[model samples]
Target chain A: MKARVHISLKTGVHDPQGKAIRNALSGLGFAGLGEVRQGKLIELELDETDPDTAREAVDRMCRGLLANPVIETYHIDLEA
Target chain B: MKARVHISLKTGVHDPQGKAIRNALSGLGFAGLGEVRQGKLIELELDETDPDTAREAVDRMCRGLLANPVIETYHIDLEA
Candidate 1:
């Protein structure tokens, strides 16, 4: 099985890294870019598992390890 | 319009950050986790634009700013 999870800062949270990257993009000549926000992509390979069960496991993993819930939220896609 | 771009280190490239996160996951008791790779997700809100031209522009953005071609590759999803 494979999974891809994206974790991002919640709306209204300041993102200094994203701002820095956006500034760099415009400085490098990308026009009409309205706003930029950055997140993390986490790809994982897992042992054979039921999709629903695996998703539950992953949700727990995110809550316990992959994210700092106070500042971020996560979404995931799982494939077998 | 909106776009989400994910850029990752290619296979065989060393990723210390990924390793660190994987170790942390295991420490936090995520079991049966085989492997992990970390990447960046960049979200952009753009002015109304043709999808094809926007994709082209974004490809340039990745090549020039979002990724270091020496070690990364990127994919994008565009939505209006």
Candidate 2:
């Protein structure tokens, strides 16, 4: 199975990296841009065949190591 | 419109960050895991309303600034 975790900072939290990117884009002549937010995408390969089990494991993985629960949120996608 | 850019290292390029994540997962007792890869997701809020124009601008953004043509690949999704 394959699992993908999308981890992103909470909306209220400041994102300096995203701000830098937006500024860079503006400097490069890209106009009318609003907010630019950046996040992390983690792709995992798992041996489990069952979708439920795979999702559960990946959820655990996100909670344990992939994300900071207090300031970040994560979504998991599983494929078999 | 909204634009999302997903940037990832091309296959065959070394991924030390990914390897470190895989090792950490193993340390956390996540077994039966295969390759783990990491990527970047950038979300943009655009003011343009036309789909074609929005997409074109974002494509330019990816090619010119958001992605490294050398070893990184990027996919853009625009929403209105």
Candidate 3:
């Protein structure tokens, strides 16, 4: 099974990297762009066959190291 | 409008970060894991209302700065 984790900053948290990207876009002539937020995507290939177990393990991975719960939120997608 | 860009490394490219994460997961006791790949998710808010325009602009952003085309591939998702 495979699990994909999408991690993004909480709504109220400031994202300096996003701001830099937004500015870069404008400088590159993409002036129509507005605000930008940056996040992470982690794709994991697991030996486990059960979707439930894989998701649970990946969820633990997210809470433990992949994300900072205070400022970021993560969602997991399991694939066979 | 909003556009989400998913940037991932091309197959066969070495990813030290992914390896490190995988090692860390094992250290944390998630030993059932196999391979892990990490990527970036960039969310953009655009001023354009037309989906076509927004996607085109975001696509340009991806080609220009959001992704390195040589070793990475990116997909854009446009949202109203």
Candidate 4:
């Protein structure tokens, strides 16, 4: 099975990297762009065949190590 | 309008960051995980009201600055 996890900083958390990207975009003449928030996408190929089990394992992975629960939130997408 | 750009390394490109993350996951006891790939997700809030215009601008942003055409490919998603 394959799964993708999108991890993003929760709203209200300061994102310096995103701010830097926004500034860079403005400098490059993209003035119309508004707030930019950057996040991480982790694509995982799992050995497990069961979709339910795979989803649960990836969810655990996100909570255990992939994301910082306090400031980051993650969404999991299972491949059909 | 809102747009999202997902930038990922093309197959055959070396991904040191992804390797490091994979190693870290294994160290932390996530052994069932297979080949792991890491990518970037950039979320943008645009001043443009039209979805089509916002998508085009974001696509240009990806090609011109956000993603490397050689190793990275980007997909743009426009919110309704």
Candidate 5:
């Protein structure tokens, strides 16, 4: 299976990288850009046999490796 | 409009972060997990009047700020 995992900083967490990008945009004359939130996208291939197994495996991957539970939230999309 | 910008390292460019993530997953007992490619996702609220304008704005943002064209590729998703 193929999975796309999106991991993002939880709301209320300050994102310096996102802010830096926003600032760069403003510097480049992109006005009226309200706010920017940056996250991580991970595309991976897994050998899980089924969607259920893939979900469980992906979730574990997110919690154990793909994300930092203290500050990040994650979602997964599985494609065969 | 709301836009999602995804920025990723170009192929052949080494991604240490992605490699670290893959290693972490393996360490956590996620076997059969193949290679991992990591990218950045930036969600922004913009004041563009239309999708075309938004696309133009985002492309500029990506080129002038959100992405390093030398090493990264970017895609945009616009929502009204």
Candidate 6:
């Protein structure tokens, strides 16, 4: 099984890195760009066969070690 | 229009960040976890209305600024 976690900052959190990318894009002459946000994508291969179990464990990982809940939000996707 | 860029390292590239996450997960008692890889996701709000134009512009942005072609690969998704 495979799982993916997408971790991103909450709406109100400051994202300087994202802002930098937006600025860089404009500087490169790619026009008509609006708000740009950046996040993390984590791909995992799991030994667990059940999708539900894999998702549950990955969710726990997100809460404990993967994401900082105060300012970040995360969602898990499990693939069988 | 909205576009998302998923940027990830190529197979041969080493990802220490991912390894660290795997170690942390195991330390936190996450069992049956295998290889973990970390990547970047950039979300963009584009001013262009046409999907093709938006995709092309984002593709250029990926090649020029968002991703390092030597070690990373990127795919773009467009949403209306």
lDDT against the true structure, each candidate: 0.89, 0.91, 0.90, 0.89, 0.87, 0.91
Score chain A of model 2 by TM-score against the reference chain A.
0.96
For candidate 6, list the clashing residue pairs, or say none.
none
Model 5 chain B: worst 10 consecutive residues (lDDT sum): B57-66
Per-residue CA lDDT of model 5 for A1-80, tens digit only, reads 88988888998999998898788888877898988999999988887769998999889888876789999999898999
lDDT of 3 at B6: 90
Q: Write the per-residue lDDT of candidate 3 for residues A1-80, one digit (tens) a residue.
A: 88989999999799999999888888887886677999999999999999888888888899999999999999998889
The runs of at least 3 residues in candidate 3 whose Cα sits more than 4 Å from the true structure, single-residue gaps closed, are none
**Model 2 interface RMSD, in angstroms?**
0.6
TM-score of chain A of each: 0.95, 0.96, 0.95, 0.95, 0.95, 0.96
Give the residue spans of candidate 4 off by over 4 A.
none
> Estimated TM-score per prediction?
0.96, 0.96, 0.96, 0.95, 0.91, 0.97
Where does model 2 exceed 4 Å of error?
Answer: none
Ranking the candidates on lDDT from highest down gives: 2, 6, 3, 1, 4, 5
lDDT for B47 in candidate 5 is 82
Candidate 3 structure quality by residue, lDDT tens digits, B1-80: 98889999999999999999999989888887788999999998888999997788787788899999999999888888
Better candidate by lDDT, 1 or 5: 1
List of clashing residue pairs for candidate 5:
none
Give the interface RMSD of each candidate: 1.1, 0.6, 0.8, 1.0, 1.1, 0.6
Per-residue accuracy of model 2 over A11-52 as CA lDDT, tens digit each:
988999999999999999998999999999888999999999
Off by over 4 Å in 5: none
Docking category of candidate 1:
high
Per candidate, chain B TM-score? 0.94, 0.94, 0.96, 0.93, 0.95, 0.97
Best candidate (score: DockQ): 6
Select the stronger candidate by DockQ from 2 and 5.
Answer: 2
